[model samples]
Target: MVFAMLSHAAIAQDQTVIEIQSPVLVIDQDRLFAETRLGSRAQADFEAHAQALAAENQRIEAELIAREQELTELRPNTAPEEFRAMADEFDARVERIRSEQDEKARLLNRSREEARQNFFGEVAEIISEIVRDKGAVVVIDRRDVFLSADRIDITEEAIALVNEKLE
Candidate 1:
């Protein structure tokens, strides 16, 4: 009896077919490719900027460290006014470095925002074209779609169509 019940359950599971009405078509290719290219460009730009900043920071930090070390070693023989002047200079340098870092961060954020907008614009254009050509009643994210027939997967066609436009 238990074996029979198990067999019946398995057969039911196999027969189960989910159907989606007004099935949502996802243009993942457009999102994926567009975002990928934009992100790559953004990352490249970011990396280049970061490397420049890093090199500059390293030079500044090394200079500051050397100065401090020299001051420490010379403290025994150094005059009070000279020591005070060196300390003040170090403080000024620190403030300048902090301000520069803050400005770079703001610039990086602005660049990223611009890149994201550009990627979205490219993706939207492809989606519009696909909708016009394929007569897609609605386009939705794949995550929102519960089930769909394989035949209705217009993703490849949409990708091809969009690539043509891109080229």
Candidate 2:
């Protein structure tokens, strides 16, 4: 009778262990961001803004070059003091333009970061929903796992959920 009881207890313990294992789902967050509609739109907007900034920088640089060329042409004919004043003014303008451009670049970076944070916030909620629906006890980023079966990956499902929620 003791032997049978011990065997029954061991079987129950094994069953509990099996139940505790649950399921682990992996998500490729990079893939999620790259494939999602919202992410793609954000990327496109950022690229467009960056291109506009680059064009404006080019225009300002061209103007600076023109001013420098004009200064070079006037240098020999102009009085020393007058030439010095023009050079000083040109240097100051260049500095001001550079400062403004730096500030604009910093603002763009901050905006991009904020957008990313918002995207991740939405994704986190979607992931939680998916975990509950799929009976998964743990969800890990695919990048963190060195070896995982493709069957355990829920990236596509997660992306679908994200798209549905975001849209």
Candidate 3:
């Protein structure tokens, strides 16, 4: 009888009380948005580069159009052999420009990938530091956690730590 009572008491003590709030994850969402917006220096650079590339492409297209018009106007007056040579030259130039544009696009993609890796590395480092400081065994997304007390909400603290590092 004593063993049965002791086992019952132990089981009761091990039970957890759960209280869930629908808006609990909102706190973490705000912190994440604020931190991401503040820390996205690479993102700004990427945008600027993208704009420049687009402008250059537009300019190249305009130039090609003008060149094609000039070639067409010159065609009716030229000897057949000379016209063929000029057309060949124009084709070669267009091909070269296409190749160069492909290379430029590849370079841009590589640079963006490198910037992404660097940004994520910094974020992970800041999060690890916050985890250590907060004595949290593991951190999960707020949406995944079923319930926890207000004391367990460390999202703002982690965001602050990330912002400090970003600055």
Candidate 4:
């Protein structure tokens, strides 16, 4: 009689366990960005800016190398105090240039981040519309998931929507 009672209670408990039936959607942000027109434009612009900065850096580096060679050549012929002053001035200049280069690199990184934020801002709205249309209760990045069927992936759909909206 006790075993029958316990079995009935267990069945009741199992019946009470609720299961979520909501749909889940997945997006591949990297693919979406690369495939979208606005994202492609942003990438090209960023690349051009990076190339320009690199060329400028190379020019500055060449100038510094020349200055260093000149200073080395002058050290042998110059008086002790005069050579010390020149050496100190050269060291100060090199430090200043390094600081400037560091600042430039930081600025480039900031610009890249800003561009990404702006791109995502626009993409978010489109994603929302797609999510609602598909009746998905939750959205997850494709990169974060270990496994998902292609049918559940919304990256291509999101990319299409983004391009259509942006264009």
> Which 10 consecutive residues of model 2 have the lowest summed lDDT?
14-23
Candidate 3 lDDT, tens digit per residue, 39-85?
Answer: 45666787799889989999999999999999999999999899999
Q: Which candidate has the highest lDDT of all?
A: 2
- For each of the candidates, give the backbone clash count: 0, 0, 0, 0
Model 3 off-target regions past 4 Å? 1-38, 131-159
lDDT per residue for candidate 2 within 1-167, as digits (tens), equals: 99999999999887655444448878887788878998878878888999999999999999999999999999999999999999999999999999999999999999888877878887898888877876778989899999976767889988888889889
lDDT of 4 by residue, 112-142 (tens): 8788889989888899888887777788989
Give model 2's TM-score versus the native structure.
0.77
Q: At residue 122, what lDDT does model 3 achieve?
A: 64
**lDDT tens string, model 1, 18-119?**
112323456454345444544456567767877887788789788878978887898788898998887788788788988987798788778766766675
Best by TM-score: 4
Instruction: Give residue 98's error in model 4 in angstroms.
Output: 1.1
Number of the candidate with higher TM-score, 1 or 3: 3
Error of 3 at 64 (Å): 0.6
List runs of model 4 lying over 4 Å from the truth.
1-22
